[model samples]
Target: MSEVIWWKRGVIYQIYPRSYQDSNGDGIGDLNGIASRLDYLAGLGVDAIWISPFYPSPMADFGYDISDYCDVDPIFGTLQDFDRLVERAHGLGLKVILDFVPNHSSDQHPWFRESRSSRSNPKRDWYIWRDPAPDGGLPNNWVSNFGGSAWEFDASTGQYYYHAFLKEQPDLNWRNPEVREAMHEALRFWMRYGVDGFRVDVMWHLMKDEAFRDDPPNPGYREGWPDVQRVLQVNSADRPEVHEVVRGLRRVLDEFPDRVLIGEIYLPIERLVTYYGEDLSGAHLPFNFQLINAQWNAPTLASLIAEYEAALPPGGWPNWVLGNHDQKRIAARVGEEQARVAGMLLLTLRGTPTMYYGDELGIGAVTIPPDAVQDPWEKNEPGLGFNRDPQRTPMQWCPGEQAGFSSTKPWLPLSDHFREANVETLSKDPRSILSLYRALIAFRVQRPALRLGDLRLLPCGERVLAYERRLGDDRITVALNLSSEGQVVELSSRESHRVILSTYLDRQTEVATATVTLRPNEGIIIAA
Candidate 1:
């Protein structure tokens, strides 16, 4: 692999536009708001920014339900605003990747409206629609990710349409050759507009079972929660044909120089590798989400790290994600005490690193009042207590009105800890988690070993985690304290390891041997 395409080793900051910033007084974030924050992103040392869907939508799935693939929603801004955002981001040495939701479109989309008008319409086959059984029941028992049946009855067509998520988001029929061509055309439109690449939304759900057989029951089911037991199989996704779709998309992207494709696949490490394609031609990165779901302990985390490094196919790149719009923030999950260590682990890992907005500021989840909840998932399951609105609140730029997110009231509440976690406060504090994240990202950019390196785990006890990243002659060793109490890490190699970076409370100058002391949750990167 030529090192020319530096994005391969780059860090991508994901900005959920609705929660990032709001330059307009509409409460919703706009492209201009993103343009205003370019300097902050560039200063964080990220190579690119992956902005989540801002396409024309009915807000059914909060931009995931695209009503128009080619245009920006009025809520976000005009087409000109998007172009300016692309230009400004490029000027700041940051590549821009757009979220491409190719699998489905909002039911209100013009194409879907036309398709459902009549069976003989030219766009009739654009979406998957099948007739129900003689009993008037669904074709199968496939459950939607958001709960309930995956099929929705269309009164106009007298047939059921497939929807893996919300009923309003109808699945596109990849079986239709014309539909595939149209999706490719959408890709071409963006590529011509100077967009670097695409972060495909629900990439594995592009296809469904041809026979539409009922899924088998899950073994993890319990008697108390009938809804939990009903989630037997995600039959609508992970079809065998999904790979061919990815390969075809990759070929289209190959037409443009330095263009890349990334897939959002939440499968295990073994299956996730296949999305990269058989000959290193499919997705440039298939979003390794181990860190997002793994247990945050020394033994479990170490084992997961080793498994991921081993599972990646030869020559295929690996990507790490700590949090996204769907899940809770890491600071809230692992506790604020371990936030710095988590950031170090994320930035130092091989391959690309993607940081969710507000993650660098050590921002935890906020409390969204019941009346303020906008997530359809929580709205549907009343008192279920599973709400994502807390993590999706607007970013805190300052401690002032609206947390400096906007002049008007925000769509959601700000974290009570905003005063302590806001960027304004942490940017000046050297020992803050925000500072540690910046230092780690800067160190990663300057070191090639950490960018494209082979990972090797060193002998360390339960409380101390140690590893070495090596690329050719450059090698960097890292040791982290995983416990609340300090631990002494006695490196097997007694050779002196020059300290390159550290978040330790004590600024120790020298250590004759490889052995070093680490304060609780303290981490150090050394060049051996």
Candidate 2:
């Protein structure tokens, strides 16, 4: 058998730097701030940290619209601070993963600046620029993931450039070998600084159809859905040629040992698994976000997990994420009680699990005041409920002023319940959600069955989701009560079982009967 990889067995904690901590009192978290909290993360039992984009940007889409790929944003500190952060994280035996946004460059980027300068400029081909349609409208029917047309007209150059997201973020022309080389070099630049890996942003949008064909209108489009979803992005994203770009990225990471490449793909399980590429040469893990959007019910989740497990490529590894910067918090989506069950579910899953920074503390969405609205998505498509500001709020560290996230106010508002739901206060509580997360992560680390075992979905009722993870004699069963009521899951085996951990953090080593009686909104891990 091949040697197990850290990214495969260990948990990854995602820290949105803008909200994690603020060391310089600038109301923004920085690399130095993250470095200071390494001990907290280490104690949380997560194996790695995936920091969101902190590279130089004009803040168009926050840091996602990167202007300089090789350096840190001044607001987040300098390249030296990043190096020290990696060093500190390594000292704590923690791996570091950075978010790589390659699909687009900020309109303020020098490359895009030159590209939009003149039609005959040397860098004009670096971006996806095209002549206007005969109707003098959009180059194609492509819609921006943010809203409206994906093409931004550059009157100075007399052409339109494509942007999968905001118009300020112009898509890079990956078909150009020069652009590919430059982006690959950017990866190497960070790898040399001891960065462990990257979670590639918009991995499927790297390559668009060469012919710039119009995307087909979605037959299932609803009246209130986001404008981007009104049309199927058939020509604008997930193109077959994107695999070649992924393989090239894999080659770049393969030049170094044990470096992981995770693709931020929002496709279906079948299409998402294809990102592993032919012969497993593509991304190491195409992020499985099914749980993020899936209905919070046993039947739906059970089928989703089973289908995802069955869809993995030969050596493809699986990963799970319940919440992130872009979506509603798990706690908000499933309520505070179910979030603990969700934590247990995430950590005990067969493959890697990524814990969103504040989710461990049961931090849900914050009410973003209209005067403080910051997310470009919410601004671009107003009143459509596209606001992500609630989920991207400052991390709740303590009950002190500003929730101990910063000396002053944070870039975004803090949650209303931050005083009660914070790491400082909850860490001392034996039954707190933070305690549950720490216990779950530690439990997963100590159990081989939970770490690298093959999963077998067990028979269970509609309100319960049960699965067994086994590697030889080492076997563990995880059953979660997905609803708000009590659930009893029958066991197939007559062998005695011991309760290893529970979401409430109250039970341990208790022998189980023929059936496991789960409290409302609870999850348990049993050892047989």
Candidate 3:
């Protein structure tokens, strides 16, 4: 509404392909399956969609380890099916953003294969390859984020290759001009196909310290990794040269009008802001992940809200994410009753918001059986227990068998609670979280303040969290009772605000002494 791109001001729905909708009865969702659901997505008021990877892979990391950068996997669909999906999404007024995994590739990828061949091969230097230490140990003390050593021995080359994640996902050597150019060509292929943009995976790891120094010791331990120690010097995949690579990518995006580039950086706000590039044109939004890590409380939430607003680079866009394919769903994290409060916070924030699919239906994590778990992190990190299978289960659409997700059995079991949380069940209930999410999305669409506004935090009072979003002549203030009890916050004398939206079970019209009372875990948006 504030002269921003439509994709920037509206919500982005993230669909995990393997679990979203399966059409071929193969128990796994594909491109055609997602194309068939365009009407449902349109009805949900989403402006765009960001689908997870559907590229060819060995399914080692559930498609994150891409074997071919330009081709869709047989499990997902053909490239023609993908083009049809892109065409259909655009026809329905939905922009499509693809997941670009430039950090690493499946070990089976041709580039990796060539890189791992004889050291004399022209592509041998395309990936990060190094000699073992004098003691035949890993090149350094670096550990993979997934766990264990990041280096793997290549018997053919007699050298070790770096893989920041699973061994199958070998890290690319961006330091190689040829490698960077090849990846750039991959971008050209997608952009030429009319894809709107990309959600860069582990983008920070594009560049690494070339010297391969030993990682410093951890300051403290949680389960196994450090809590306060900075992994930048040793393990920070985001090297200084990453900016040059980003500039190259940004230039590619600049070639197309209205294209976007978002990066997933799991770092703190300070380090995250650097991804914006000093030229004010790098990653359009380095996802704000503080809320994902912050404790669910009034003080912590208030503090983080202020920190993120101030920490973002000047003129750079901000985006909020409550849940993703890799993390626990909000309902499972904060309880179903409080999930609406989290939704209100997300939708009412002053920037773009990305919604994980099934979140609008208040879906919770499935109780995964031990045999059905497929997350490599859980399999490798035994005692740490970092399983993400429950969060990536199939979307529940109805009360029928397989929850109407697929005619056949699904890759992961749907929760029994799907009988109550399915879209069909929530569509008929006006008081459901699904309804509340729609109302807020519509409310955001009609408001300029919530889209591109400057934020002002109101004074903290009586278990309430309040803030004002202002854009030009438009202004809206939001208040939330993050606690389990009611809270009363006084409003300005001349400010008679109308309740534009609320996530409470029912609306309360009573106002006592210019103070509005909020029910347990309630949130409201007021426009003056």
- The Cα local distance difference test for each model comes to 0.85, 0.92, 0.85
The TM-score of predicted model 2 comes to 0.99
Kindly report which residue stretches of model 2 are placed more than 4 angstroms away from their true locations once superposed: 1-3
Q: What is candidate 3's lDDT per residue for 1-528, written digit by digit as tens?
A: 547787679899999999989999999999999999999999889998999999999989989999999999999999999999999999999999999999999999998887777898899888888899999888887777787788899887789998888999999888898988888889889989989999999888898887888777755544554222324344446678898898888888888988889999888888898998986768887877887878988788888888888887778788899999988999989888789999999998878999999899898867888888788888887545468987898888888889889999898888879899998899899989999988888878788788778888888564778889999999877888888988887775555667766786456343334677777888988766
Instruction: Return whichever of 2 and 3 wins on lDDT.
Output: 2
Worst 10 residues of 3 by lDDT: 226-235
For lDDT, the strongest prediction is 2
lDDT measured at residue 291 in model 3 versus the true structure, 0 to 100: 76
Using TM-score as the yardstick, the better of models 2 and 3 is: 2
Question: What is the per-residue lDDT of model 1 for residues 22-114, given as tens digits with 9 covering 90 to 100?
Answer: 988988888999999999899888989999999999998899999999999999999899999999988988999999999999999999999
Model 1 TM-score is 0.96
**Residue pairs in collision within model 2:** none
Question: Which of the two candidates, 1 or 2, achieves a greater TM-score against the reference?
Answer: 2
Candidate 3: misplaced stretches above 4 Å?
A: 224-236, 508-513
> For residue 320, what is the lDDT in candidate 3?
94
